[model samples]
Target: MYIRERRRFVAMSLAAITLGACAETSVRPRQLAGADPARGRDAAERVVCAACHEIPGIAWPRGRMGGSLAGFGGRPLIAGRLPNQPDILVRWVRDAPSLIPGTGMPPQDLSPAEARDVAAFLYTLE
Candidate 1:
Protein backbone atom coordinates (compact mmCIF):
# COMPACT_ATOMS: atom_id res chain seq x y z
CA MET A 1 0.00 0.00 0.00
CA TYR A 2 2.88 2.41 0.71
CA ILE A 3 4.36 1.80 -2.75
CA ARG A 4 0.97 2.44 -4.39
CA GLU A 5 0.59 5.70 -2.46
CA ARG A 6 4.08 6.87 -3.48
CA ARG A 7 3.31 6.20 -7.12
CA ARG A 8 0.06 8.14 -6.90
CA PHE A 9 1.80 11.12 -5.27
CA VAL A 10 4.50 11.13 -7.98
CA ALA A 11 1.83 11.04 -10.71
CA MET A 12 -0.01 13.99 -9.18
CA SER A 13 3.20 15.98 -8.83
CA LEU A 14 4.07 15.34 -12.46
CA ALA A 15 0.60 16.41 -13.56
CA ALA A 16 0.91 19.64 -11.64
CA ILE A 17 4.30 20.34 -13.17
CA THR A 18 2.91 19.75 -16.67
CA LEU A 19 0.02 22.09 -16.08
CA GLY A 20 2.36 24.82 -14.77
CA ALA A 21 4.58 24.47 -17.79
CA CYS A 22 1.63 24.84 -20.12
CA ALA A 23 0.45 27.98 -18.33
CA GLU A 24 3.86 29.59 -18.55
CA THR A 25 4.18 28.98 -22.29
CA SER A 26 0.63 29.82 -23.30
CA VAL A 27 1.10 33.33 -24.73
CA ARG A 28 -1.39 35.22 -26.84
CA PRO A 29 -0.81 37.89 -29.47
CA ARG A 30 -0.13 41.40 -28.22
CA GLN A 31 -2.86 43.99 -28.56
CA LEU A 32 -2.66 47.77 -28.42
CA ALA A 33 -5.01 49.63 -26.08
CA GLY A 34 -8.04 51.23 -27.81
CA ALA A 35 -6.95 49.92 -31.20
CA ASP A 36 -8.91 47.50 -33.36
CA PRO A 37 -6.94 45.26 -35.70
CA ALA A 38 -10.01 44.34 -37.76
CA ARG A 39 -10.82 48.01 -38.38
CA GLY A 40 -7.21 48.71 -39.25
CA ARG A 41 -7.24 45.92 -41.84
CA ASP A 42 -10.33 47.39 -43.37
CA ALA A 43 -8.71 50.83 -43.48
CA ALA A 44 -5.67 49.41 -45.20
CA GLU A 45 -7.86 47.88 -47.87
CA ARG A 46 -9.79 51.08 -48.38
CA VAL A 47 -6.59 53.11 -48.74
CA VAL A 48 -5.11 50.75 -51.35
CA CYS A 49 -1.97 50.34 -49.28
CA ALA A 50 -1.13 47.14 -51.13
CA ALA A 51 -0.42 49.24 -54.21
CA CYS A 52 2.89 50.38 -52.69
CA HIS A 53 3.88 47.74 -50.14
CA GLU A 54 3.17 44.20 -49.06
CA ILE A 55 1.18 43.87 -45.88
CA PRO A 56 0.69 40.44 -44.42
CA GLY A 57 -2.92 39.18 -44.20
CA ILE A 58 -3.80 41.82 -46.84
CA ALA A 59 -3.57 40.03 -50.14
CA TRP A 60 -3.55 41.55 -53.67
CA PRO A 61 -1.50 44.24 -55.41
CA ARG A 62 1.59 43.70 -53.22
CA GLY A 63 3.66 46.23 -55.11
CA ARG A 64 7.42 46.43 -54.70
CA MET A 65 7.79 50.20 -54.42
CA GLY A 66 8.05 49.98 -50.62
CA GLY A 67 9.28 47.46 -48.10
CA SER A 68 7.12 44.58 -46.94
CA LEU A 69 5.24 45.27 -43.70
CA ALA A 70 5.75 41.83 -42.19
CA GLY A 71 7.14 41.54 -38.68
CA PHE A 72 6.70 45.26 -38.02
CA GLY A 73 6.14 44.63 -34.31
CA GLY A 74 9.72 43.42 -34.02
CA ARG A 75 11.18 46.33 -35.90
CA PRO A 76 13.00 48.95 -33.87
CA LEU A 77 12.02 51.94 -36.00
CA ILE A 78 9.34 53.06 -38.39
CA ALA A 79 10.41 54.62 -41.76
CA GLY A 80 13.94 53.98 -40.48
CA ARG A 81 13.72 57.10 -38.31
CA LEU A 82 10.98 57.46 -35.72
CA PRO A 83 10.63 55.10 -32.76
CA ASN A 84 8.23 52.22 -33.37
CA GLN A 85 5.66 53.33 -30.82
CA PRO A 86 1.90 53.79 -31.25
CA ASP A 87 1.86 57.58 -31.15
CA ILE A 88 4.77 57.98 -33.53
CA LEU A 89 3.27 55.40 -35.87
CA VAL A 90 -0.04 57.22 -35.92
CA ARG A 91 1.54 60.55 -36.76
CA TRP A 92 3.65 59.03 -39.46
CA VAL A 93 0.67 57.31 -40.99
CA ARG A 94 -1.39 60.45 -41.02
CA ASP A 95 1.32 62.56 -42.62
CA ALA A 96 4.63 61.02 -43.53
CA PRO A 97 5.83 64.03 -45.50
CA SER A 98 5.33 66.31 -42.52
CA LEU A 99 7.41 64.07 -40.29
CA ILE A 100 10.17 63.60 -42.86
CA PRO A 101 10.26 65.92 -45.77
CA GLY A 102 10.48 64.27 -49.21
CA THR A 103 9.60 60.87 -47.79
CA GLY A 104 8.38 58.49 -50.44
CA MET A 105 5.44 57.46 -48.27
CA PRO A 106 2.69 59.92 -49.05
CA PRO A 107 0.50 61.50 -46.39
CA GLN A 108 -2.51 59.30 -45.89
CA ASP A 109 -5.81 61.05 -45.18
CA LEU A 110 -6.63 58.70 -42.33
CA SER A 111 -8.12 60.25 -39.21
CA PRO A 112 -6.58 59.79 -35.78
CA ALA A 113 -8.85 56.86 -35.02
CA GLU A 114 -8.07 55.15 -38.29
CA ALA A 115 -4.35 55.62 -37.72
CA ARG A 116 -4.70 54.09 -34.29
CA ASP A 117 -6.34 51.03 -35.75
CA VAL A 118 -3.55 50.69 -38.33
CA ALA A 119 -0.94 51.04 -35.64
CA ALA A 120 -2.70 48.35 -33.64
CA PHE A 121 -2.68 45.97 -36.59
CA LEU A 122 0.99 46.64 -37.24
CA TYR A 123 1.78 45.89 -33.62
CA THR A 124 0.27 42.43 -34.10
CA LEU A 125 2.70 41.58 -36.92
CA GLU A 126 5.00 39.74 -34.60
Candidate 2:
Protein backbone atom coordinates (compact mmCIF):
# COMPACT_ATOMS: atom_id res chain seq x y z
CA MET A 1 0.00 0.00 0.00
CA TYR A 2 2.83 2.43 0.85
CA ILE A 3 4.54 1.81 -2.51
CA ARG A 4 1.27 2.26 -4.37
CA GLU A 5 0.61 5.61 -2.65
CA ARG A 6 4.10 6.86 -3.49
CA ARG A 7 3.67 5.93 -7.15
CA ARG A 8 0.31 7.73 -7.28
CA PHE A 9 1.88 10.87 -5.76
CA VAL A 10 4.70 10.82 -8.31
CA ALA A 11 2.25 10.40 -11.18
CA MET A 12 0.18 13.33 -9.91
CA SER A 13 3.27 15.51 -9.60
CA LEU A 14 4.31 14.70 -13.14
CA ALA A 15 0.86 15.52 -14.43
CA ALA A 16 0.86 18.80 -12.53
CA ILE A 17 4.21 19.75 -14.01
CA THR A 18 3.04 18.93 -17.52
CA LEU A 19 -0.13 20.97 -17.09
CA GLY A 20 1.76 23.95 -15.70
CA ALA A 21 4.17 23.90 -18.61
CA CYS A 22 1.31 23.79 -21.10
CA ALA A 23 -0.62 26.64 -19.52
CA GLU A 24 -0.64 29.89 -21.52
CA THR A 25 -0.52 33.36 -20.00
CA SER A 26 -3.19 35.97 -20.89
CA VAL A 27 -0.90 38.91 -21.65
CA ARG A 28 -1.63 41.09 -24.72
CA PRO A 29 0.52 41.84 -27.74
CA ARG A 30 2.61 45.01 -27.52
CA GLN A 31 3.52 45.75 -31.10
CA LEU A 32 3.15 44.77 -34.72
CA ALA A 33 5.45 44.94 -37.74
CA GLY A 34 4.88 48.63 -38.42
CA ALA A 35 3.17 50.23 -35.44
CA ASP A 36 3.72 54.01 -35.53
CA PRO A 37 2.71 56.45 -32.81
CA ALA A 38 2.57 59.29 -35.30
CA ARG A 39 0.21 57.29 -37.48
CA GLY A 40 -1.84 56.41 -34.46
CA ARG A 41 -1.95 60.05 -33.43
CA ASP A 42 -3.16 60.88 -36.90
CA ALA A 43 -5.82 58.24 -36.57
CA ALA A 44 -6.74 59.58 -33.17
CA GLU A 45 -7.10 62.98 -34.68
CA ARG A 46 -9.16 61.57 -37.52
CA VAL A 47 -11.61 60.11 -35.03
CA VAL A 48 -11.57 63.45 -33.24
CA CYS A 49 -11.55 61.54 -29.95
CA ALA A 50 -9.96 64.48 -28.21
CA ALA A 51 -12.75 66.74 -29.32
CA CYS A 52 -14.88 65.54 -26.40
CA HIS A 53 -12.32 63.50 -24.52
CA GLU A 54 -9.41 64.93 -22.60
CA ILE A 55 -6.76 62.76 -24.19
CA PRO A 56 -3.33 63.81 -22.95
CA GLY A 57 -1.96 66.94 -24.64
CA ILE A 58 -4.73 66.88 -27.26
CA ALA A 59 -7.26 68.23 -24.85
CA TRP A 60 -10.70 69.57 -25.83
CA PRO A 61 -13.70 69.73 -23.51
CA ARG A 62 -11.87 69.25 -20.24
CA GLY A 63 -13.22 67.73 -16.98
CA ARG A 64 -12.48 64.13 -17.80
CA MET A 65 -14.51 63.76 -20.98
CA GLY A 66 -12.82 60.42 -21.30
CA GLY A 67 -9.88 61.40 -19.15
CA SER A 68 -6.23 61.66 -20.18
CA LEU A 69 -4.57 58.69 -21.79
CA ALA A 70 -1.09 59.66 -20.55
CA GLY A 71 0.56 56.96 -18.46
CA PHE A 72 -2.02 54.56 -19.92
CA GLY A 73 0.57 51.82 -19.77
CA GLY A 74 0.77 52.11 -16.00
CA ARG A 75 -3.00 52.06 -15.57
CA PRO A 76 -4.72 48.81 -14.69
CA LEU A 77 -8.09 50.18 -15.87
CA ILE A 78 -9.47 52.55 -18.51
CA ALA A 79 -12.19 55.25 -18.23
CA GLY A 80 -11.77 55.12 -14.45
CA ARG A 81 -13.19 51.57 -14.82
CA LEU A 82 -12.60 48.31 -16.70
CA PRO A 83 -9.33 46.41 -16.81
CA ASN A 84 -6.60 47.85 -19.04
CA GLN A 85 -5.89 44.56 -20.74
CA PRO A 86 -5.13 44.99 -24.44
CA ASP A 87 -8.10 42.90 -25.49
CA ILE A 88 -10.37 44.91 -23.24
CA LEU A 89 -9.13 48.12 -24.79
CA VAL A 90 -9.70 46.69 -28.22
CA ARG A 91 -13.29 45.91 -27.31
CA TRP A 92 -13.79 49.33 -25.77
CA VAL A 93 -12.36 51.08 -28.78
CA ARG A 94 -14.31 49.01 -31.21
CA ASP A 95 -17.58 49.14 -29.32
CA ALA A 96 -17.66 51.31 -26.26
CA PRO A 97 -21.43 51.30 -25.69
CA SER A 98 -21.60 47.56 -26.24
CA LEU A 99 -18.90 46.89 -23.65
CA ILE A 100 -20.55 49.11 -21.06
CA PRO A 101 -24.07 50.38 -21.45
CA GLY A 102 -24.49 54.11 -20.89
CA THR A 103 -20.76 54.68 -21.13
CA GLY A 104 -20.10 58.35 -21.78
CA MET A 105 -17.58 57.65 -24.51
CA PRO A 106 -19.00 57.00 -27.96
CA PRO A 107 -17.96 54.02 -30.01
CA GLN A 108 -15.45 55.47 -32.44
CA ASP A 109 -15.67 53.87 -35.87
CA LEU A 110 -12.25 52.29 -36.21
CA SER A 111 -11.42 49.31 -38.36
CA PRO A 112 -9.82 46.25 -36.75
CA ALA A 113 -6.33 47.11 -38.02
CA GLU A 114 -6.68 50.76 -37.12
CA ALA A 115 -7.88 49.91 -33.62
CA ARG A 116 -4.92 47.60 -33.12
CA ASP A 117 -2.54 50.31 -34.17
CA VAL A 118 -4.20 52.77 -31.83
CA ALA A 119 -3.93 50.25 -29.02
CA ALA A 120 -0.25 49.84 -29.78
CA PHE A 121 0.18 53.58 -29.43
CA LEU A 122 -1.79 53.69 -26.19
CA TYR A 123 0.32 50.85 -24.81
CA THR A 124 3.42 53.00 -25.24
CA LEU A 125 2.10 55.82 -23.04
CA GLU A 126 3.98 54.62 -20.01
Model 1: runs farther than 4 Å from truth?
1-31
Considering summed lDDT, which 10 consecutive residues are worst modelled in model 2? 21-30
For model 2, how does the per-residue alpha-carbon lDDT over 9-123 read when each residue is reduced to its tens digit? 9999999865643331124444445656667666777888776655664545444566677787667667766766666676787788888899888889888777776776777
Tens digits of lDDT, candidate 1, 51-87: 9889999989898887898998777678887656666
Taking all chains together, each candidate's TM-score versus the true structure is 0.73, 0.65
* Candidate with the greatest lDDT versus the true structure: 1
